[model samples]
Target chain A: MDLEDTLLMMPGPVPVAPRVLRAMSKPMINHRGAEFSAMYDDCCEILADVFQTKNDIFIISGSGSAGMEAAVGCTVGKDDVVVTLENGKFGERFKKIADRYGKVNPLENEWGYSFDLAEVEKKLEEGAKAVTLVHNETSAGIQNPAKEIGKLAKKHDALFIMDGVTTLGGDDVKVDEWGVDIAIVGSQKCLAAPPGLSMVSVSERAFEAMDEKGELPYYLDLKAYKKSGDKSQTPYTPAVPLFFGLQEALHIVKEEGMPARINRHATCAEAVRAAVAAMGIEMLPQLDEFSQYSNTVSAMKAPEGVTGNDIKKDMLARGITIAGGQDRLSGKIFRIGSMGNVQPKDIMLTIQELEVVLKKRGVISGLGAGVEAASEVLDSLL
Target chain B: MDLEDTLLMMPGPVPVAPRVLRAMSKPMINHRGAEFSAMYDDCCEILADVFQTKNDIFIISGSGSAGMEAAVGCTVGKDDVVVTLENGKFGERFKKIADRYGKVNPLENEWGYSFDLAEVEKKLEEGAKAVTLVHNETSAGIQNPAKEIGKLAKKHDALFIMDGVTTLGGDDVKVDEWGVDIAIVGSQKCLAAPPGLSMVSVSERAFEAMDEKGELPYYLDLKAYKKSGDKSQTPYTPAVPLFFGLQEALHIVKEEGMPARINRHATCAEAVRAAVAAMGIEMLPQLDEFSQYSNTVSAMKAPEGVTGNDIKKDMLARGITIAGGQDRLSGKIFRIGSMGNVQPKDIMLTIQELEVVLKKRGVISGLGAGVEAASEVLDSLL
Candidate 1:
């Protein structure tokens, strides 16, 4: 099937903006030439502004997982003790990558739960070289306490590495203020670009830590990336078309302004939550005393009458795409993303259609109630 | 520094077809959905036809180096002996990547030189776990002895891995016949698709060999790719739009027919060499006893009076983007790529322009001679 009439609302591979899509049609150029070098440097500057950091930014020609691999593989050397927080699938993935190159002290928590600061601090006190944390766990729709964890790791003299895959651009991420030594984001997330590239911002401290270690995997090695970044080049040929899309997407981010973009995501997320709650549905990782709800993608618990798969299937049939829970959470929760250029009108339509599906599945008794509630939230925002 | 009205004659990141460029502007879709799965499977079938193999094909979401890493990292275990043939930059890169995971016995040869079969057989006879060879060395414009080297590795019971980055689509590559266990090709080369994704074909024997080893890195792991290939998926999110372009590019390849495509590349190479020879310029490698010229890119030695950099600067100033030599070849020679959608007319214009530039630089006595020679070669092909 072609990609003509479908609406992509998954956590990633999000629906790209029209202009950004058009940007990918640009002609190819020499990757090592001045034209590409200029584009590369422009992307780094734009991404720096978006990440709210003065740190060094590298554009890697891989998905978000490759960026995560770089964060783990480059800084954590062999036999080095590293602390990793695993509260969701991506968190566990960080631990897995770190385990490949170093001694990992995995601090496991419940899937829908956020990290416990006390536990993290205690683990850090055991003298780890680096700490890996997920800023926003998309699976559970929880924004973990990266700020506190970053501070703890800083005090412990450990480099703070973060997976900002789903939250960096759609939400507020203060890389420098949060004491994050390394932060990674994907092209298709809140940036509204096509997938294939990952933007990584590395702090000076992180570079120093990496320099102390031996070379990591060739393609995933951040040191090689840094060496090439000094001249606005990558060690290998990058995805040229994706770079064009990302540059245009970053320009759009600048035009809308990061603050307004983050606010829009927050408003859309609130409308979604209000609409879903009106249908008597529960959200996963129901906000606790510590963790906050994710403002990019909302994860809802499947109703008692049907599985998450059923709702996803019905949505797909209607030309809309939402995501079912991953791994153990599969069939338990469905996620609706509000990241990137998802407008209020799109959210209203999604909620309306979601309500129709819920009623068709005999989960909700009333129709239009979810839409009405969402419209109220939308009206307040306007 | 805009990408418009400029010629790209580099080894890769070559000029793309309009249809392939437009295809990249298609809207995004769910990566895990049936639509993407179908597109992925279709791409694999088409790529298998291009690779001339019935082996399992996996589409990776990184550059060609990632595919190379997957080939080396998956099959070569720790302490395993991996014999790598180094004749150019990419060959040296393979050695570096293999050295990361296994015991590498590098058979270093001069750049622009083909592998000595006696030397390769001698190394393979020493009982290695794998042997890495580049099918076409782009940096030196030499097509190496991959077929003979592959047989040597097979005879020694060693897995044969090859870097087919620059030759897969533009030249004839028989993976099974050449005894290549794992072959890698990039999207931006002869496929006429933009860079970002790399396609890999793995033999059953390579799969068995990889199974005997431990897990490779997550993103570059071929096992995960194989598992996902069963359902036409990737372990991580792929570059969605790039895949769209690749599918269309593969369709173009089918329409043109592989034999015609290979012949077109060969004719273009012959015309380039004939034209340069008429202009009194020498080519790199100069035809060794066993090695042949590459059909995709032509490497020309700098004339007596100027360096490769001078020629590159003059061409760039004229809005014609040719490439200077890479690494050690820098300022020593220049490259002219005839791969992808670059047509006979483009080559004709490039040769004509080259003569003008040479005459203006006082490196040649007359104009139009190069184009005259190229036209003769083109007419002979017709």
Candidate 2:
């Protein structure tokens, strides 16, 4: 019940800002009224700034996955070939959704690794309708090569669909510059807003692709959203309260400024990495050539004698909610999120708390070293 | 900014209960955590009571249309024959959605009329994969003969899908007795919650049908929902705040008791009907053999020399929100809603406000006739 006292350090549904929470509590307004239209317009404008795109943005009243489905459902029809890069759970999700509507050639990669650009280009050489990529794979704490993949999509004359779910607001995401034909951002991630809404930006090329594909599933149809969005409306009733929260969240983001926000995320993530390394913990990616560790989330391997669930449970007992590895890697790795409304103080506290858990479990000897290293990072940032 | 002062009497995004607003302000929780699971279980139990079924209830993150799409997308496959009943704008929307997934045989009726059961049965007799019906069409203020349609669907061995967007909680809905295979309800409508989440009840028969149909679009996939729901999870992140609001709204409904709740809605609607009739206004359906007026919303014809938009503008000036006709009926009819957190007093006040607008426009002579009629119904109800 004391939701604010507990720190949500999971990949999403992160600790929301006080302003956003208050915004969500505001009385409901008529969805088709002028007031809602003004709010909608203002939110879209602010979202464009956050997404770093001039393209039209459509806010779906569902989760990030719904936006993912819409991106594919509207463009890829039966028998259409779509090249999907799968490196983590979310990447596999894109493939699964695309498979439902079209023929998908999945360029699979290891969960904790990034895609090989050469192999991805080879897959694209087959000439597909679109190329789908997840910029930040929350499951593996990896950021895929979206910019490179976008280039491949362009070379192959394929529409580039990017899932910026974890990285959009917390990091530098230039959709237009990256040649991302369609980009989707989840509200709960780095946006520091409550979950339930997904904002998508569409390029003219993607619009043309959908037009050629004809009509899509009624609810996921992009054409309907575009038509209604011109009038500051959605084809169906939207989650109005979420929109209010998102607007306030965006205002907070503006106040902090994007450059500073991205830098803060980088600093916090680096501090977490430094502290984990100081505690003699192994990160999941192991500092490979790709170095895909996400600034939004840090996925690290469990200590030799302990499981990730043990760390998660221990953290939860201390009022900090850390995530365990999912899917095939369940109980193998633990993840700490540094996205959204998370501050340096929270990360410093989390690192210190993690040290206590590790030392009590007899996994690490240097109890205070982790906290000290993280503190140094925090102090330098200050 | 003064949202509370402006009465939102639109069919949806209806005025939310105070308790529901407070619930939305609750701090965010991990969507996949134990605490969330407990909340999820509680919400499902409450929703089962509201839907009047022993079937599984799904809380989708999107609006009502997304629920409608899931109901159809999961059951009907491509090239299959689907019988759709269309008597209003929402009915037409159902038809449009079904048409994308299957071959639709639309049984069209007049906008302000209920479906002719015989015609629907005849269409179903043609042997369809599914039959889609809107229990209450909010646009034309019509509640179709869902029980009869459900029976027809069963007789024809077709899946019965019903859109209870506007009627579920405000009116008596017996899902099991009525043989509704899949029923979708919006949180913002009769549920008296904020607009965002949609609750859907699915029967075993519908699930078996979907399994036979193979995979559906990823986000709307019912199987994923069922799988995740078993563990008290959603396939994707949900709107946590909205879920809190819905749970609180359901709790409030339980406190009020169902019989009393249904009676309250009926009494308030009757008051509005009596008041409008006294004001010499023609209700859209004209109270003939097939009365289209809904207990939640009443649609009426615009008076001579006054468009529905004119009335809506006038109402807005007086700090009330009413809906004008949509699509083809635009500017012809106006609708006043008495659903969600609305009470007899709100309806009476709306009628009195309408009388002022009508008198100012020379549409009615007796100024207090409408208010007096409404007050009489309110007194009788009390």
Interface RMSD of each: 1.0, 1.1
TM-score of 2: 0.98
User: What lDDT score belongs to each candidate, Candidate 1 first?
Assistant: 0.89, 0.88
Docking class of 1: high
Question: What tier of docking accuracy does candidate 2 attain?
Answer: high
lDDT tens readout by residue for model 1, A86-171:
88899999999988889999999988786778888999999999999998998888889878888898899999999999998889
Candidate with the greatest DockQ versus the true structure = 2
Chain A vs. true chain A, TM-score per model, equals 0.97, 0.98
DockQ of 1: 0.82
Clashes of each: 0, 0
**Residue A17 of model 2: what lDDT?**
83
DockQ for every model comes to: 0.82, 0.84
Error of 1 at A91 (Å): 1.0
Return the TM-score for each candidate structure: 0.97, 0.98
